[model samples]
Target chain A: MKKLMITLLAALVAVVTVSAEVPAGVKGKKLRMALVKEWGTGTHMIMHINGAKSEAAKYGIDLSVIDANHNLAKMAEGIENAVINKMDAILISHGKADALTGAVKKALQAGIPVIVFDNDFAVDEKTANGKLVSMDQYDLMMGLLSQMALVQALDGKGNVIYNRVANVPPTDKRHRIWEGAILPTYTGIKVVNTIDLGTSNPMPKAQTALETLLTTSNNIDAVYAVWDEYAKGFYNAIVASGKKIPLFSVDISDQDLAMMQTHPEVWKASAAVNPSLVGRVQIRLALKALAGERIPRYYSMTPILVKSADLPKERVSMKDLAKLYPAWGSSDAFVEPWMSTLKK
Target chain B: MRQEERRLTTKKLDIFGFFYKYGTILVTIGALLYFSLTLDNFLNFNNVTNIFRSVSIVALIGLAITISLTIDGFDLSVGATAGFAAVIAAKFMVIWGYGVVPAVIAPLLVGVVIGLFNAFLIIKIGIQDMLATLSMMFLLTGISVTFQDGSAIYNFMPIPGGGIAEHTMSKAFLAIGQGKWLGIPIPVYVMLVVALLVHIFLNYTKYGRYLYMIGGNQEAAKLSGIKINRYKLIAYVMSGFLSALAGVVLAARLGSGEVDAGAPYLMDGVAAAFVGFSVLGTGKPNAFGTLLGALLMGILLNGLVMMSFPYYSQDIVKGIVLLLALGLTYYKMKHKG
Candidate 1:
């Protein structure tokens, strides 16, 4: 009897620890979710969409993606439609707060759970009634990590070429960190040149500008790219000039990875958050809210520092990122006990 | 007394004509001299080559706009067509694993097809050139986005559905944009050759005269038995071809195929063409004037950049320069009338 009791207790503990019981209200229920995006064209946005789709599928939730194509009116309409359809949850990405606040408020008033990524909505606990969550890729931390890497690499003293694209929300945040935090602390670092071409295809423009700068001046010691797109151009120019200047940047993608790996000596490091994981977490948070669980008003995904020296010799994609850094591809931030009972 | 007044009037007209004829050239020279005198290394060989190299692509697009102006038609679609060609060429090399010849030639062929379609809309369907090409611009931008699934094509990029794109841009392909001969950038040489050819074609060729005649007076050209529609078709087709060539060079320069990459060139190209109208008092779009216009803008921009001028404010300067050039030409025309 004593041995049997012990075995029974062990079995109970294993079940409690290993598996989550489905909430009685949502058990085997079909849920519908909508992802209204400001734009969904780039590699990062695509991965984010895929992540959301994968997560929604695991729960047998119908996921609809409405790409606004950078039109604010379309994005507002997307939210309004989601509210009219009475979606179980809604996910928003990269939109102007003022244009979306009213629609977000309507969704909240309708009692639909709302999760936003990379956009800050004015609605808070009072407006949302605790059903809204806003999340970002932690642009602040990304900027700090990337700039610190450059500072450390150059021993905090070097003439650097800085690249920036102003007026963008995420980039604005990163620039704040640089201007507010990094530059003041690192006095030894002098910005010799700043480049902002403001063109859609910035690579060629950036390459040409840097090439011109190189001919006129040779005092550049390093390059700091606020976005990896600019870094790619700087990398090309540096290689062409046969210069050994190191590059540090924010953001990562398969193409960025390939470039970093090929010229590890030039592209020293980049700080990034997995966009796919960002999507998955947004869905998870929405589902948790749908399950009547209380969630934070704001959440930020932890960023990872990817160093070229740490990369493997063979070519690798985002899929293989987890093998290099365990925290890269998966996040348990919004995982709920009921999630385990959801269908895969 | 009347004879003396007539002499004064003729002398004044001669002075005005001289200024109208040489105003743009004089301004360009003045800016060049100013930069060379004030800025360090502004007159360096590399810097001069850099200015020419930078404007080369825009100059090619300017030539496209110049051709359309010859037939008194506007092509708002040239920029979009160039962007579409860029994406297509990138697709050919990176997505389909093709060689440089196919990658380059295929987009030029696509441009020709686009031009034919534009001609059909403008000539057969009786739509205005502005409206037709504007619609073509939107359509081509949409098609390019759809073709690439709204993603850039680069070396080792991941495709939309699955798998990695294995083929990288070939060296020969990149060389068209990045290579140099005799210490001159390859694109500069290409631009010079194309400019010379276009200048010759427009000024010296019989077909060129017919096109200009149609532009100057369409009904008169038709009455003179000059196939007006045929010449217009030829003009648009040539416009498309040159725009595609610009796109190809842009792709090579970036070493990637970026969507909407050629859009920014449209305004600059148009500005260059308009500014060309005042060059040597041509009063119409000419290849040599177009090239000069691009060079003038390139010099101003290069000087501003070297001086660490804010990028946002640089456009204001460009607008003022463009306005000045246009103002000179228009003021001359109004006075003449």
Candidate 2:
């Protein structure tokens, strides 16, 4: 009986010791964080916000989301406001680095950890006296995957309609791949037309332009859309024209998924990183940095290629996307054991 | 000696007037001719229709600006009103699952309400037209963002707080933007019909004359028993309705409601209206001139795109052309004064 009692005691002790616990600096603390975005529009941005919000809730964090509405000045001001309010950390998404660098420096000077997604800042730990985590979605890989799919699907020989939006960092990177890698590799693929419509409501403009192109030119084989917004337009134009041109693009949303599934033959494939996963990963990194964890200065999220033929015929939202591709909706990166206990 | 001086002045005025009237038309023709000569298929029938289709929305918005100018008032809210109408239309279809008719008519009603609000602010409160409309612009933009929670509205889109939108954009609505009848784009027909109606209303109607007289001199119009306030009300209402129409067409063309979709048209619309002031030596806003101004811009932009002009450089070209057009009109005015 004494031996059994001692065994029970040992087991009890083991269970108690192995239970999850919050990290030292974050334990029982009412933490505050701010997510300042350049703009919060479209499914991608909304998903990012939703992911961050859900993750922040798990940590009992007071997360405030500030949308600058595509105004750089306002985005800069958002970081300043967070610094003034003395938030625990800051997360910035998509702004001109030049406009945000000074504000980021201010936050760093205040000893606040800053994690930026997609927007590059000049500050480092040595220069800014604080932790700065720069995260990218690996747009280059996204470009390569989508462009290669286009070239491969066409068998490297066809007339193509290429859409380009210049000056934007992601689009610029995508275009660089097209200009340098794809063009050199697929010499048989002839670019019959290049379309660039200024970014506001581009779908309709792209559709109109493509419709005109279809009427004006013949023998077009396929199209490469750098952004899914352009892809949506091209898809619609092709449908309206009753043409059988295949489209390949970057980025994914519930709407884009629906279109792709409905007409897999046309919207052949798209390469994208789950936007919600991006938001969750960002929060994870921010929490890790706050807990005095060592984090790399730069991190990139891997992108996945979603082919239309792979999707089920039934409609699926971003939530359902994970069943088909596990890595897409969930990320294990930057997750610490303490995070499990931090959940409210 | 007095007769000789009068004759010299008349000749000079005639020469200036001739250029003012024909300058925009001549320049448009020169561009068309040049593009036709230099670019492949630039003068194709389909290409010409495409250019008109592209500018159709801008032309409608320009007509809205022109109407506002008739009463010496500028409706800066036109673009916002158009955007607001688009959001409301999309909500009716994508969110509320309503039919096409309500989606179209509801926004027109909203436009009327906006116009009534502008009329009250400008006529009753005696606020400056520019300030009143500018405030409306900001208000509508904020309301639009708030309405859809800052995301665009499309068919089967996932709404905020959960669940997917049920109804997609209807075929009839898409046809308004994407469909063509008799080998011409539908928007081109809409633009031409609206322009013709506005031309008749502005040039041949007593109401248009009263509005112009009020714009020329409000006090003089009031003294002449023209009911200046009533005329100003008419001008603003027309502006609001037309801007809403432009927004509707834009929504149809895109088949989705994007926030600030109509915002880009504001500058182009205003430019077309101002440029119309010197068209045909009218020295004032007119519908035909506004249509012509939009066409000129459309032709130049389309030609530039075909020529492989960089997109960033295209804006510079637009600015330069705008400056040249305005410089001639204002310089002539300055000289006459």
Candidate 3:
């Protein structure tokens, strides 16, 4: 009896780290969480942080934000520190999975729930205290749609410029779709320029890069920027050249809306990730993991395709966004009943 | 027999002297010829103009760095200073909704203050110029991040309060970047004007001579009645002035302020300034040489990109160009000494 009890206790301890399930809810319970970001360079990211703050209020969670400013070592160190501090949960946003994997694994080993947003760790969902939350379906859509935007604009045959930074998870996700799903579909499309807009403010650099491309080759039909800022840079150069080439990209900000409205003819369309909702969703996943609720290893977001023609004459707000994204305000549809681990 | 020997030596010396003086120029012409022959559009008027217009910013910034290098100092903060100026100028119009004068002056004054800050640290605090300016680079870059709250400032940026930004680059400011003055880019003219003026000042003026003297031997210049500190101070301030000026033009050209606007130029400026060392075999920093350096890089970049080379390859080529230029200049200088 004693020997059998020892084996069972060992199994229980192992189970506690990886697959322990909570009874019902942890309402009114205060949990301290840390958010580690690769960089705070985008307005959408700022919005996401704000959403995390406001939405996290309901659960009375105290959030600490650490900005790595796109430094890989700093991002890892931030997660390591959070693990040392024994935060109830830690969420890392938009950092390289490989760089932070060891730190995140260590956190999980400590029985601290590690929730990730938009990082491609490719870790097994059954890992201890680890949850890879958020989805890339929307990002894939961004690529497909951006490609579609180019094809439609070019009347199904034209030269295109491809810009995306490899190793950046979200960018890579969209880029993979573009390379795999879209490029093959459009057999006539020729990539005249390829720029790796790696995780900086892409506007200025893209302008210079595109300007060089323009001086060298004037036969480009359209530009497919991985991000909207890159598109803006390309658009700026095109405008300067007095060319009618249109720009298509992903990500939407207030400035994007304004620029599109002002120059609708030049600006085509974009795939908008409700990063604000994604932020709230990230917080919800953190809370779910904290409560021992069943969470998927990979969660996906549905992106809203915002086009210049479909836009209203005035400025856009959250309510206006809700119409475009059904899951904009609530995280109900993403939540599910208890499951030990999610299958790929 | 002695006269014949002397003539042979002089003739041999002239051959080596010819290469040293005109190697980079020869190379520039060689590159132009190669690209012109190989790339169909490389020598097109519009393409050449584009190349010059694009390098105008690099040329202007390179000129500022050249001033510092001439005085035996280096201002690594030139790029960050440009970023700061760009941020504040954009903020003036896009955030605070101010007019053009404030937009322009705010960044310029900020530049002056930065110059003073760097000057005080180096001159008064007795820190080495490289070390002092290097520290200032960090501070200025951090300030730029804070100014925009770690995000880009564009027209109609979402304010924290509730609404969007209303201010934008006015026509006058946009014209500085977009408009042409008699078919030449305003920036090219700006580059030429600054280069010509600085060239005249450096080669023709006594003050400029004093600066070169201090650069050659600071203690010697100080002992010989030249105020070494004042000239060094002026060199830094001039760097600041021109960095800010470059940022203003960059802002005008970009039509919006970018925090990282000047970052790429740091390496490009370094290359251009070093390339200037070999120009005309001056073996010293000069405005005209720096302009040539900028044009060389501009043509190389324009030609390479027109050939549809990958973006990363462009960086490798730039590295090789800088390496070759510096290698040639350094060995030549060492052998001369």
Q: How many residue pairs clash in each candidate?
A: 0, 0, 3
Indicate the TM-score of model 2: 0.93
User: Tens digit of lDDT per residue, candidate 1, span B17-135?
Assistant: 88789977998999999998998888999889999999999999999999999999999999999988888889999989999999999999999998999999999999999999999
Best by lDDT: 1
Compared with the true structure, what per-residue lDDT tens digits does model 2 show for residues B237-301? Answer: 88999899888888888777886777888988988887777787777889998999898888888
lDDT for model 3, on a 0 to 1 scale?
0.78
CAPRI classification of candidate 3: acceptable
Docking level of model 2: acceptable
Tell me how far candidate 1 lies from the true structure as C-alpha RMSD in angstroms: 5.7
lDDT winner between candidates 1 and 2: 1
Error at B77, model 2, angstroms: 1.2
- Which stretches of model 1 miss by more than 4 angstroms? A1-29, B1-19, B159-164
Candidate 3: true contacts recovered, fraction: 0.44
Choose 1 or 3, whichever is better by lDDT: 1
Question: lDDT of all the models against the reference?
Answer: 0.87, 0.85, 0.78
lDDT of 2 by residue, A1-344 (tens): 67436534543443457556555556677989999998788778989999999999988899999999888999999999999999999999989888889999999888788988986787765764437888888889999999999999989999998989887777888899999999998899888788887666677667767776775677889988988888988988888678899999999987788788778899999999988878888888887766665677888898989999889876777777889888796888887766887785
**Which regions of candidate 3 fall more than 4 Å away from where they truly are?**
A1-29, A122-130, A134-137, A215-218, A317-320, A323-344, B1-17
Query: In model 2, which runs have C-alpha deviations exceeding 4 angstroms?
Result: A1-21, A128-130, B1-17, B159-163
Q: Against the correct fold, how does model 3 do in TM-score?
A: 0.90
